[model samples]
Target: MSTQHDAEIDALLGRYFDGLYHSDSSVLRTVFHTDLSYVNGTDGTYETMGLEDYMARIDARTPPASRNDPREEVVERIALKGDRIGIVEARMTMLGRNYQDLLTLINTDEGWRVLTKVFSFVERKD
Candidate 1:
């Protein structure tokens, strides 16, 4: 039973990683809630925004096709408490910089969706 639950969490984590790697806003819409909020490391501040704002950022981001080759690291951890809440951390590498994000997820009637994300620059060892 535990293994099955782990597998489910793993799939959720994968979807989150794939979404960012491909810059697919629709995938993001699936993973994140309508009231999602996040802190932008580049700005060093927290901002509360709707799903549309989040999607806009994804759209504004320089697509992987435009970059040399963006690489997304594996999800380090994904944990769920019962069936209502979860968390995941993933590493991302692009443009000679390393970034990390810790995401908080909430299970809604529809399914698991990210409620918030806290992102930061992990390292820049180029």
Candidate 2:
């Protein structure tokens, strides 16, 4: 892929972080596919989420940003596979917990959108 494509993916990731921090479903919808599958294993049991349900959960929450404790998310890696598929790993911290997310993205006609996510979290004792 060209540098331009890489830049676009980077920009999309930026929006992802923004959406996650603010829990803004609008911003999130821009980057997540309609058929998204989200998985969380923080509790030692897997919890799965679908796109619409996840959006609804976002809407019901009070954004951490509003509390001045917005989650901090960092993109650790982005690996593109050919022109259509990519993998992204990111870290986030909020409420004394650290989160690690591995996202699968596809470059669709609408642009690069996350198709699936697998995540885990650990609570900080200190």
Candidate 3:
């Protein structure tokens, strides 16, 4: 792949973080594949779903951006498995929750798309 691959991943991840913070389904749709699997295993809570349901959940929430929440997000690492597959480790905070996300992506004809997301989050009380 080209050296610009890293930049593409970074830009995609930026959109991911921005989408989550703002609860913008349209933005997120560009980040996640339609058949994407969503896994949440945090503090003994195990939940799994698909992109449509995930979007519904996002739509139901009061967006952090609306509350003037601070965004503390970072991409810890990204590893490419050949030319078509990639894995990313990321961290972020929203709605007083701290999250660690492992995202697996597939490079499609349309570009890189998040195919699966396994994440854990801790609720923060302050």
Candidate 4:
């Protein structure tokens, strides 16, 4: 990838990570496609959900009170096959647990938007 492409991917990574940490749903919406879907691993089960359902689930699980001090870390790897498509793998640590998310993004009329996401939890040893 050229330096400019790398920079764009870096910016996208930063926005997505910052949004998750701050629980900024508006930012999340911008990164994710309207029809985005994913399977979230929780308690040894993979629960599939769409964008709206996922947002509601996030709202339900993350209490407004607890978000006063939300913590997050994201390590991402991006691969660009061409100018309009890329894959992003993000390993995230949030609320003392680790999760892995693989996302496919496409440059659309509105800019880069997430096409699909596959995610799973990673058991942390402490």
- For each candidate in the order shown, give its overall lDDT on alpha carbons: 0.75, 0.88, 0.91, 0.74
lDDT by residue (16-90, candidate 1, tens digit) is 777777788887788888888877665555455667887998888876645657575767877777778878887
Candidate 2, residues 19-124: lDDT per residue as tens digits?
A: 8778899999998999999998778768998999999998998787888884677889888888899899999887567889999999999999999989998986
How far residue 101's Cα lies from its native spot in candidate 1, in Å, is 1.2
Better of 1 and 3 by TM-score: 3
Error of 2 at 14 (Å): 0.8
True-structure RMSD, every candidate:
2.6, 1.7, 1.5, 2.7
TM-score per prediction, in order, is: 0.79, 0.91, 0.94, 0.80
* Tens-digit lDDT string for candidate 4 (19-88): 7776667777888888887767566786787899877765556643255643555656777777788888
Ten residues in sequence with the least summed lDDT for candidate 1? 1-10
lDDT of 4 at 19: 73
TM-score of 1: 0.79
Residue 43's lDDT in candidate 1:
56
Which sections of candidate 4 miss by over 4 Å? Answer: 1-3, 41-43, 63-76
User: Weakest 10 consecutive residues, lDDT, candidate 3?
Assistant: 1-10
Off by over 4 Å in 3: none
